[model samples]
Target: MYHAESFAAMGWETYIVGYKGAKLIPSLLQVPHVRELYLPQPPAFIANLPRLLFLLWAPYKILFQALTVLSTLLGELPYAPEFILVQNPPSIPTLALVQLCARLTGSKLVIDWHNLGYSILALRLGASNPVVGLAKMFEKTFGRKAYAHLFVTHAMKGVLVRDWKLLGIKAVLHDRPPSHFHACEPTEIHDLFSRLDLRPAGEDFLPPSSPPLSTPFTRLRDLPPSSLSPAFAATLPDRREDRPALVVSSTSWTADEDFAVLLNAMAFYEKRARAVNSPPKENPQKGDKHDRLPKMLVIVTGKGPLREKFTQDIDECQKLWQWVRCVPMWLEAADYPLLLGSADLGVSLHLSSSKLDLPMKIVDMFGCGLPVCALGFDCLSELVGEGNGRVFKDAGGLAAECETVLKGFPHAPELEKLKQGLVLQKSPTAGEKWNTWAEEWDRVVKPIVTHRPGVE
Candidate 1:
């Protein structure tokens, strides 16, 4: 969607071709100007088949779907499109068909490499599988045929250059969020919460209270109301003057992320909180405000296969620590930005399938000026650093970091520096960036398209 919008902004007549069951299909259908070509979605039974069977069936399904998509394109497009950008990793039959169509229409081909096809298959089927080898062969052949290539990270580009020897006008285009997602004002956050029904509609609003240096920060009790739906706000606890620090993580429930690390971190944080709130019996720091522990509200968004198991784990953790409340639920696209804006801190456990592609979730989190605790990966230091966020090696290290942040209370110096770093980090807005990228891409591919044998 972002790429399509960017192309449209660059004065290109944009059309989208995809499947019926894609995540943003419904939203895309509503846009009047963007022509859409959709293939028939697989039936539930076929879609739900076991992994091996599904993989076996996928090639036939993709081939049939590709024919439908190509037919639709031929019928709907008045002229051959100047450029056809195809996303990779369903790369076998789809790319072959796309290459065929591009040949017929004299359109320039561009492959946006998200990941190699074989890498994804290798996760389920071993790397040594003959099928994996075949997929890699297809990727290399078709990838080398494209007029230009776009990669998400420099590491990805390096892999292709060294391993596949794919050479062309390639560019590294990092994903960015829309301008509206950047550093929201306090009032904007309040309004968004009210609109999303995360806060009560007509109640008196209290701005988050400042943290005190001397006393225990018990005043940080009021937190974002918890409910799967906004209508359940009435059933939530009464709003307080101060809100607890909000920590959030969004995941796809896949093996790529280690949710156990996050869970263990929370457990460690809870233990540290208990020790802080209740001092040792020998000294008994009764009146000391510095010993007070701050409250936390952790919201992990997105539903996946591990949700049920993780939910049970979260329940067990909550039972041990009353000060901590964690909720896991699927969020609509409209609610996602609001939830991120409301959060004070973000946590990411995403381990990249390839060393090259950075976690886009962390980028979105930074766009909202929410600092994060992310797991270490190749090229991660390019995005995360000392002031903006910390990268951890294990659950214990992550947990220790979380405890350190919470213990600092309402005004941790490190937290303040992170917020400042986010503010200082500057880049073009998503639209501007995309428009610039499209212009550059056009310059690179136009000669190839125009120089075709049939073109005047």
Candidate 2:
């Protein structure tokens, strides 16, 4: 969507042909020169087959997707585009089919390499798995000879080039948050929470077999439909001072992110929080129930395959937790950025499938001027090189970092230091600060997109 938006803004007649069921924003749908074309989704009975059956049906699924993609590319477009820009790592049928489409249509293929698809498959099946070996071969066979290649990290570029002996115009285009991710002022924060007052939408977030996960967060609410819906009064941290330290995290509830690490860390923090010396002990008669450390309200946003299981775990764990509360809620497109901007801190559990890639979540957090404590991986230093965030190896290490950084909670000096570092992390364009998604996109990708392939 970001790439298509950028292309449309640059006056390209862009079309985002994706599978149906993808929840795209209305703004993207209504963009001037951009169009949406969706491929039909398979029946739920076929799509939701058990793991073994799903594997057995993989070949058919791939064939169906390939045919649809080719049809969309060849028949659905208003006219043949000069370039067919595609993202990699969904490299199975999409890459191979797109390659074939590019050849048939006589268009240039520009592949944005996010990560190696084989490495991601390897995360589920071991590295030595035969399926993984075949996928690597598949990706390598079709990954070469692009018109221009854009990568999220320089490390990914270097490794793929060396291994696959790729020949193309290669560039590293680091992910940058768009303009909407800026920090909110106190008044803006209050207004956002006020407008986003919670409502019950059990059908969206609850399991059909079970009663709505009586937990606070599973009830997903709509923004536009309920924008004027009578504001049912629910517990909202409307006042910034009165609220616990608001921590935000997002996930897709997938194996790539080990949410268990975060759960364990929060459990440790909960125990420590309970053991803290409180003013209530000293002033029992006055009934001042205050502690040196502030309570933490961590709200995780995003819905995915693994969400149901993880939410259940949080539900079980929160029963024993007092000082720390972990709530999993899916926010609407408009409200997501607002919550990120209003958050006191951000946490990332994104473990890259290929260690060469970086997480865009932290970039979004940095865009919101929210300090982060990210789960460590090999390429994390690339993003955290400026000391804008801290990295931890495991649950214990993450717990230690949380205790170290958020010691004073709402008035945490260490967190403030990190936020300040994020503010100072800027780029100079003609000696002026110009560090936004649009500018950076123009700086790196625009040149490649416009350059003649014949040019040296």
Candidate 3:
């Protein structure tokens, strides 16, 4: 979407072809200069067949992808495109198919390396698996032959260049959030929360004496932060100035990212919150009671295949936990960024499939001036640096990090300090690495996308 949007803004007509029902940024389709060609998904009976039947599935899967992509790129496009940009990982037959189609259509192929398809397969099947070995060889053959290559991290670029001996243009294209993501105003937050119809975690957490109330969002839209309620209080809980800690995390719920890590962290956090807030059985004394983790509402957003299972896990966790509420939801494109901006803190459990690609969610969180605690991996430090975020290796570490930053919640100086650091990073002059998507696109990508034969 970023590539298409940027190209469209640069006055170039862009064509984006993908599976018809796959999730796309809704705003992408609205761009006047961009045309979208959606391909049909394979028949449900074929696609939904048990995964163990690889014999029946693999050939159909490859043929479907190959035929659809080839037909769309070659037969349906308005004109013969100068270049075709493709995302890697599910590279498989797509790479081979796209490469063949690109040749037949007299177009250049640009490969965007998000991660290695072989590495992702290694998570499910061991590295020693023969199929994984074949995937690596296939990617090497096609990926290395790209007209240009875009990498998300220096580490990935270095590794691929050295090992695969890749051909053509290569550049580290760091992922930065688009302009839609920024710290939202109080009114925007309130409007989103009101529409969410946020219920309390349970009766034990807060006792609501009155029936649920409603607000006309239009009337509240123009109000200032002071006139508006704090975001965490927008739920059906106490309407006092005090608010629950609002933490947001978004995921597609794929197998690569272990959702269980977050579930465990939330459980750990719940225990700590309860321990800190509960009255002691012995001599009753309050010593710096305010300096403890606040009750939290952890909103996990985005949809995926694992959503039903994850929601079931959340339900079970809620049964035993009182201080934190974990709920799964899907947000509209515009509201997604607003929620991130309105959040007190963000959590990312994106254990990268290849350990060489940084989580895009962390980038969005940083863009919204929301500091994050993200799962650590090889190339993560490139995006998640010291002040704005912290890295955790496990669920316990994540819980501890969350407790550190959010300790005195609602008035957490630690969280505010991180947020300030993220705010500074929005400036192009903040540091070389802080360049916005537009600036970086102009510097690194525009030249390649716009280059002409025999033209400087």
TM-score, candidate number 1: 0.79
What count of clashes does model 1 give? 2
Over 4 Å off in model 1, which ranges?
A: 21-32, 45-48, 195-241, 283-293, 427-456
Sort order, lDDT high to low:
3, 2, 1
After superposition, the stretches of candidate 2 with alpha carbons farther than 4 Å from their true spots are 25-30, 43-51, 195-239, 279-291, 427-434, 452-456
Candidate 3 global lDDT: 0.79
Give the least accurate 10-residue stretch of model 2, judged by summed lDDT: 209-218
TM-score of each: 0.79, 0.86, 0.89
Ranking by TM-score: 3, 2, 1
Candidate 1 residue-wise lDDT, 125-173, digit = tens: 6778888888888878878766667777778888887888875566666
Per-residue lDDT value at 165 in model 2: 84
Clashes of 2: 0
Model 1 scores what on Cα lDDT? 0.68
Q: What is the lDDT of residue 285 in candidate 3?
A: 78
Identify the leading candidate in terms of TM-score.
Answer: 3
